[model samples]
Every structure is written in structure tokens, then in C-alpha cells.
Target: MGSALVTLGGAESVVIERSRVKTLLALGGCVLFVVGSVAIWRAESPVIGILGLVTFGVFGAYILHALFRSGPGLVVDDEGFTDQSSAGAVGRVLWADVTELGTWSHQGANVLVVGLRNPEDYVARLSAVSRRYARVNLSMMGTPVTIASTGLKTDYDSLFALMNERLERSRLRLDSNPPRT
Candidate 1:
């Protein structure tokens, strides 16, 4: 079971760091894929090789970056959550804009899907590459913000519960003291 570091400062927050062990494992797998892709390219088809290189090679680079990168992968605070878990991460998302929280399964991995009231607002904040990926996520998952615990220290369930709790608290605060007009 994975656990997040919950800080009870002035404002409550959960900080989830990247799992070095999991990241190393992913990097190892990517290296294998790259090696296999190279072998296939030389012994099999150039087209397949190029495809594998393009795909796995790029992914390998990302994993490499994550391996060396420091700081928390995900941070859930009073305002919102910051996601640096994947290439398609959408920096930060406020609780007020989040409409719903749900889960999605992809290739046996459970992803925490955050439904926003105006998804385009968040989508527009991403880069061109991430924007395209976010669009794909929107089409398939009905939201652009999908948090996967692939390299994060916590699992999907833990992340979901923490976010749900924070969102609920934000809602209660908002209800008790409505925002001024």
C-alpha cells in the first residue's frame, strides 16, 4: 500500500513524491523496449524499428527525466493540486473548477480522472504536445485532467481519497461562507 505525506500546516496538504523504485523499473522496461526495437529494426523491418524508436525512445527519455527530477510528483493543497506525474500533466487545478472526481481504467492501470466545469480553460494552459494529448483524454475520459500513479509514491485509490476529501472540504468552506459578488 502506498501512502502520501499529509502536512497539517496553516492549510492541510498532501505531498506525493515520485517513487524512485517504480521509476527505475519503468526506465528498465523502456530500455528493454528500445533494445528490442533496435534488434527488430536491424533484423526485421525498418518501419517497425522506426516506430518503436520513435515511441519507446521518446518515452525512455521522459522516464530518464523523471528519474533525475526532484520534488513532489503531486501536491494537493487547500487551493488545488499540482500534477507533475506525466507528460500530459496540467500543472495545477483548483478545487472550485472541478466538477466531479472519477476513475478510469486503461491497460489495467487505474487513473484518477478529474472532471472540470470548463475543461477547455485548463486545456488551453498546456503546451502544443500536451494539448493534443489532453484532447485525446477529453474525448475518451470526458475530462482533460487525468492523474495516473505510474511513478508517484501513492496508488490510485489513495490519490482519489485524498483529492475527494480536499474537494469536499473546499465545498463545505465555500458553502459556509459564500464568495462575495
Candidate 2:
């Protein structure tokens, strides 16, 4: 693992956090932009075509705005890895705190979920922040500790390796046949 300066709150879990509105606007905008552009091209009347073109611009902005809401950064320590940028946002859970570890792909991004013992509180917060992002997951353990990535950090392989190493050191192993679904 690369040597990195350990900062405060960089213990077992680290998360870069953000608000939900940002995510919604961003996703909705992207979809609208593409659809609108195509609609504008197919429209018969010039006025309708212009209106479609205008929607394309608005939607493009929404995508960008949503991207900004999901703060980007790396959250890792002895516990888990959080690939996020927002402050005070919970990221990953320490293996000592994790009961299950699973890696999956969602929304064209490879994601890892470290299931903790009691995860209700964190999961609730995550649900609130991810109104627009559809790639969230949750399952129960004892005291759930969790972490997620913003797909904006260094790399997934490196983070996974580091997290695994830390979890192994804690004697908490992932499932023998963890699904990569």
C-alpha cells in the first residue's frame, strides 16, 4: 500500500458525504439533455426544435450539478475505505466492525459493500443522500458498519486490496464465494 498521512477521523471508516438534491438534478439533467437533443433533431417545427435544444442545455447543467453534490475523495484507514469527498460523511467500516464483505458492479461502477453488525443509522442516512443514485445496497449483520465509493477516487483494485488487507488483519474474512454480481 502507498504510504499516506493518516488524518483525524481516518480510523476504521471514512466517508466523503453530500446532499441528495445534487444527485437528482445531475442525473435528471443528463437524461433530459440527451433525450431533448434527439427530440430537437426529430421535431418537424422549428419552434419545437428550438425548445428541445434548450432543454438539452438545461439537462446538461443538471448532470454537472449533481456530479458536484457527491463530494469526491478517498476515505481509508484501519477500518474501511470510503471513496468520497464530502466531510463528516461516513465511508467504509472497519473489518472488526464488518460481518460481511461483498463486491458488486452498479451503474457502470464497481462497488464494494462491507457489511457491519448494526447498520441501521448509516443505511438510513445513505438512503436519504442517494435519492438519484440507484446503486445503493444494504443487508444486516450485528452492528452494521458500511462504506461506499463515489467512483471518483484513485482506483477500485487498490482500494479493495487495502481494505481486504486491513480486514484480514482484523481476522474478519469476506465470504468464501462472494458474488460479484
- Index of the highest-TM-score prediction: 1
Per-residue alpha-carbon lDDT of model 2 for 1-181, expressed as tens digits?
2225546653444333343454555566667666766676686656776676776665455345445654435555554555443322345444555666667676776656566665565555554444222223442322233233442333557656766767775563345545487
How do the predictions measure up, each by TM-score? 0.84, 0.47
lDDT of 1 by residue, 1-181 (tens): 3555576668767788888898889989988998998998999898998799789888888788768876788888988898888777888999999999998886898989999999999899898978987998999999999988888988778788888999999899889999899
Question: Clashing residue pairs, candidate 1?
Answer: none
lDDT score for candidate 2 against the true structure? 0.51
Q: State the lDDT at 82 in candidate 2.
A: 53
Best by lDDT: 1
Q: Give the Cα lDDT of each candidate.
A: 0.86, 0.51
Model 1 Cα displacement at 101 (Å)? 1.7
CA RMSD, predictions in order = 2.4, 9.3
In candidate 2, how many Å is residue 71 off? 7.4
